[model samples]
Target: MSTPSPTMPPWPAESDHASGWSLVRAAAAAAEAAAAANRPARYALVAATGLLRELAPEEEGGLLAWEPGTGWRCLLPPQDCRQAVADLYLPLCAAHAARPITVAHLGQSLDGFIATGGGDSYYVTGPANILHLHRLRALCDAVVVGAETVLTDNPRLTARLATGPNPLRVVLDPSRRLPATHHVFSDGAASTVRACLAPNAAFTPGAADLVVAERGGRLDLADLVRQLRARGCSRIFIEGGGVTVSAFLQAGLLDRLQVAIASLLIGEGRPALMLPGREPLAHCVRPAARLFRMGEDILYDCDLAASTAAPAAAAPNGQSLQRLF
Candidate 1:
């Protein structure tokens, strides 16, 4: 990837002696500037943490820092401001520290259904989770979904409720079945990309820019990611319709996965994820997860890479659920 622009905002100066609320403000300012410039906030936060240490040695642990040996490490205690700082910086930090962070998100009912039998899913989770998804879109460079989701939901896929700029909307439509009249296609709020298996003569171009990456009549997701990265979309958010999310999970391309589980149950409907079955329980994929209460819903934030390396532990909310293998 090309170097970020020199015109991008610089980190807080050490000489400023920022502390307490000022430190928080500085970190927030740096994050906002990075987002505005379309640059990774992690780099700026790294510099900001150094300044934080210089300003207030006692508060050094609170500022998000990156260690070469252990990756992103945060020593902050539980506090509202600290949590807020972490909420803003952690995603960017994780994205920048990794090769390319691909997070898949899903909002489903308690029984793991994403929609009703007829595909009528107005809101599975609460408003808080919806806002959280929008925030995730704001953090990511691109937001992706399957063409089936586009046809079923007709979502606008914009960062409307969030503060940051809208992400590039990506649709994986191997067969080019999605209509040009889809809201995502006609919406000019953000740039759109339509990745298909090949250039079809029958398909008419619309607001979306078309890209073809075919491999045995299938859209090569790895190639698609490379193309997106080439276009400066390093971090991707997969907002899915089951199959798309499952494909990425089975391919081991997803770094993080967030699922919002609502209180209600849809007894019969679309399943959230569909992976191949393993004969033995030990052979199943088990990711380390943390749970949080978002309004009436419970949010599961999982770290796929950490699951293999660390033992499963109870979440901060003192609830533990078996990994959805």
Candidate 2:
């Protein structure tokens, strides 16, 4: 696949689209530059996700959508930002000073759909989107999903197509309540880790690398990050339901936001994210973002609080769930 050029505007009829091809070119350039670093996964997720955001419809031939409830999928879009971010680029962009972790905050349409939010979970997104996300998994050190998500979706969060090691399985469960018989627990796709608050609580058929975050009887996001890093986790991806996504955003653990906004909107069940109800949504370290054109939906790419002096001076929000990423 030839590299998508950055000199051209990706879409045709949307003057509302406010960005240039520089971002797209920068993403590929970043990936290529980092590949020389020879770190675990090349680019930082921030740069990789940038590629996804800048992906113009022109780059990908077209977009393909599959049936709901299907596992394996393929894409035939004109050019896919998702494919660039996860598949060929992100892995080559991984850095190691404070090694980077690529975590994603994603959710389906309101009615539990990814493609067209209604009654479709499996085939809600176009084939390109599915394949693109799969690439992100391929380059990650860990893929996190909330217990609630596991119980509801029962998805096998491992890379299937590309040949390589599967990322470590990390479940963000403050409560320890997964059954040993559960699909994720028994899948053997990757090393399973239950990041829970409960003290060594029992899992039906327990998995290894149990990370306990008991900060005053609650799960500590900071501690969780520390442990993950120690275990050689340079890039992490968090795919979630509303609550989990909200927590990551609130804790400021997310380095990037890769959102696929479908042309159609659903006004019901679960919203995109359950952001904290704090009256003031304005924080000094607000995030910066860029938008990319996908088939019918738009991909919002954001860079969280990743400035040079950010993490050091920042203090955890008093009510942990009331902060921003």
Candidate 3:
């Protein structure tokens, strides 16, 4: 994959670093510059000094860091910036020093549809939500999607709108049906991985790698996650077309999920998060969520780890009761 551009916004002086947003931007820019220069991107918040410090691999001390589900913590007693950090980018930074972090996101209309009857979904959410997605791509190691997403949106899967290293693009085409002319495979903007049941010899996966995983005519989602983790992709982002995101969520593999609800309504189309029917409200997956406003869209950041078991309610024929948010 090509290295990102070195040009980035100038960081405010250390004394002027009062806002959490500014600190996050500075850290993200530094990490991108490190990647561009072929160096390790190591950064953290020093607990005692209350400063965002760049550290060497061997360095150890009172550093504040975040982990999935557990939130941010420090070696020593932390300063008063925890709330500020958490409010801005602590969730994204969870992958910084952690491993096997998998997150999923889906954008749908008020009517619970991702696309129209004919499958035409271009800008469901506004620019702010789009930027949030780009930021997710920027922070993660790999971005994943399913075959239908490749056939429909044909997304680039790059952090083009944000400042960071572009993540590896992963397309899960279990049947090997996607044409290699798709942007993720042919663009060469970022490294791509095609996960399928078998390799089609005739199809040139230009600048892309191939991985195979199947079980009883289905792609093994767990196996795919293991393979990605083995490849040093500790952080994975499931950026999708409805079905793909739904599959991950159903598998109970997602640590966090961000569902963006747009104001528009697509009455009959591809729905998001199609899970099994659950009759009882108690058996439903009720996760702890934080709401964030993104232009006209309202994003529900749900912590899947903190949620109750999602084995579906015991009641019969209660499919409509399983909706989240």
Highest-scoring model, TM-score: 1
Ranking by lDDT: 3, 1, 2
| Local accuracy of candidate 2 as per-residue lDDT tens digits, 200-222 | 63444646546566766767777
Q: What are the per-residue Cα lDDT tens digits for candidate 3 across 179-208? A: 889998898899888887777666665644
Worst 10 residues of 3 by lDDT: 4-13
Winner by lDDT between candidate 2 and candidate 1:
1
- Which portions of model 1 show Cα errors greater than 4 Å? 1-62, 69-72, 81-89, 201-210, 309-325
Those runs of model 2 whose alpha carbons end farther than 4 Å from true positions after fitting are 1-92, 108-120, 199-206, 278-286, 306-325
Clash numbers, per candidate: 0, 26, 0
Ranking by TM-score: 1, 3, 2
lDDT digits (tens) for residues 1-325 of candidate 1: 3332222211223232123224333433344333334421233234444333212434333455444333344444444224433443364444542356789999999898999988878889888678768877877889999988999999999989756678899999877788888888886778888888666776555545456667667777888887887787767999998989988887788888988899888988989999888766766667877565555676778888877633455554453533221
Which predicted model would earn the best lDDT?
Answer: 3
- Lowest summed lDDT across 10 adjacent residues in model 1 is found at 4-13
Point out the worst 10-residue segment of candidate 2 by lDDT.
63-72
